[model samples]
Target: MKKRLWVIYGMLTLATATWGSAFIAGKFAVQSFEPATVAFLRFFGAAILLFPLMWVMEKDRKKPTLKDHGLFVLLGLTGIALYNICFFLATKHAPVIKSSLFIASNPVLIVLLSGLFLKEKITRNSIIGMAIALTGVVFIITEGHILTLFQYGFEPIDFVLLGAVVSWAIYSVVGKVVLKKFSSVESTTYAVAYGTLFLLPFALAETSWLDVQEASLTTWAAIAHMSIFVTVVSFVMYYNGIKEVGAAKASIFINVMPVSAVIMATIFLGETFTLAHGIGAGFVLTGVYAGTNPNLFKRKLKGNIVKNKTA
Candidate 1:
């Protein structure tokens, strides 16, 4: 049981890392491909890759119902198609860092959605950890000047970013319930396939998609990375993590994204690591640890009390 939990945590960590890197690769891809085209091709590629694996894994599992298929379609719509549309559109309109900050509301939204829709219990530790983790993210993004958030106020694009937050929350919470009926591979594979179909019209309609054929090799490589690692590998692992741990607990791990992104930038892009990065990373890691292991702080406090008595 302990080993399985560690494996799940490792999977979630890998998923978060890939997703974090997607920000960099996606920025590169969109320089050539249209937003819809990028999303379509990415998920279309993912479906192709995941389908065979899903078929093999699900061979012995129960067959899906018509209703199950319907739910998978809905999952594709909200989680993949709609979420990417809003995400691409939002970042197009807003500054990327500001857009990321707005989208970071997803973890909190997921916790609330899980509580309301899934009847998941919200612990005090989770709430406190969520707040701390968010504070760290804001600190990192704002570069220790968090007041910038208030100065900017809300922009129109903020709503679109919020749509992404809500869309992802719905995906995580609703997908959890769906996982009860289908294996993670089945659920993610069908969702990606249908999401590709949903993205087809939008991709076709974009005149910018013509540029895709003329894209440089680097751009094509970025798209491939997004498709294979970010979409196929990361999302499957994310879904499996959600299945192993409840959505609310798993969702908090999303906070690792900005930290990973910054670290990746330092390693690959020659970006300098700042003091705010250290503090923010500390808070984010500590908060996630507390939130996911709710009893951790309590156990430590008890241990200290025992030590004091012995002293």
Candidate 2:
């Protein structure tokens, strides 16, 4: 049981890394495609990949009901279609680091929504962890001087990223309920399909896809990465991890994302990392670890005692 849980933790960590890197990819892709068009192509590709795999894997499962389909459409609309549109648009106006940090706020929103909608309990440690993690994010956003946030005020893109955060929180909370009724693959596959369908008209109205032919190879590769790895693989791993653990615990892992996003942006997008980013990441990671493992301090103290006795 412990080993299985560790594996889930490892996979969830990987999923967060991919999700973090996606901000960079989306930043690149939006240069070539409209926000809605990018959302459409991404899920359209994801659906194509997921459908056949789901059919092969779920041969013994019962078919979905009409109500199930409706629920999936809702998931597609809010989680995939709407979330991606907001995300891509935000990328156009904000830097990847700032946008990802704002999106990282979703963990707190998820915990709250899960408590309210899913009847999950909110522990004191959870609140403390959330507050600490959010503090770290604010540190990064403000570059160590939080007063700057109040003085400079928020950019328009900040609110757009906030919209994406709300959409994703809804996705995660509602997804927890849907997972009880469907396999992770089934839910993700159908949701992607519905999301793709939802984006079609908007994409058609907004952008000429002829731009796709003109896109550089780098852009296409980024889109493919977003579709396959970020959307399909990472999402499956994330949902599976949520099933194994719970939403609150799983959401904490997302604190790792802003760190990963900053690193990726530095390496690939030529962004600079400051001391504030390092300090904020440290606090965020510590808070997440403590929140998820309420007994972490006790266990560490116990380990120290054992080591001293051996010495």
For every candidate in turn, the CA RMSD to the true structure comes to 1.9, 3.5
lDDT of 2 by residue, 18-103 (tens): 98887788788878887788778878888889999899988876688998887888889889988877887776778755775678
| Whole-model lDDT values for every prediction | 0.86, 0.82
Could you tell me which residue pairs clash in candidate 2?
Answer: none
Clashes of 1: 0
lDDT at residue 125 of model 2 (Cα atoms):
72
The candidate maximizing lDDT is: 1
Candidate 1 residue-wise lDDT, 1-311, digit = tens: 87888789889988987898887788788878888888988898888889888877778877778988888888998899999999999878887668878777788999999999899889988888888888888877887777777777677787888888888889898899999988888889988988899999998888464586688887888888988899888898999999998898888889989988888888877888899988998888888877877677799899999999999
| CA lDDT for candidate 1 | 0.86
Relative to the true structure, candidate 1 reaches a TM of 0.94
The residue pairs in collision within model 1 are none
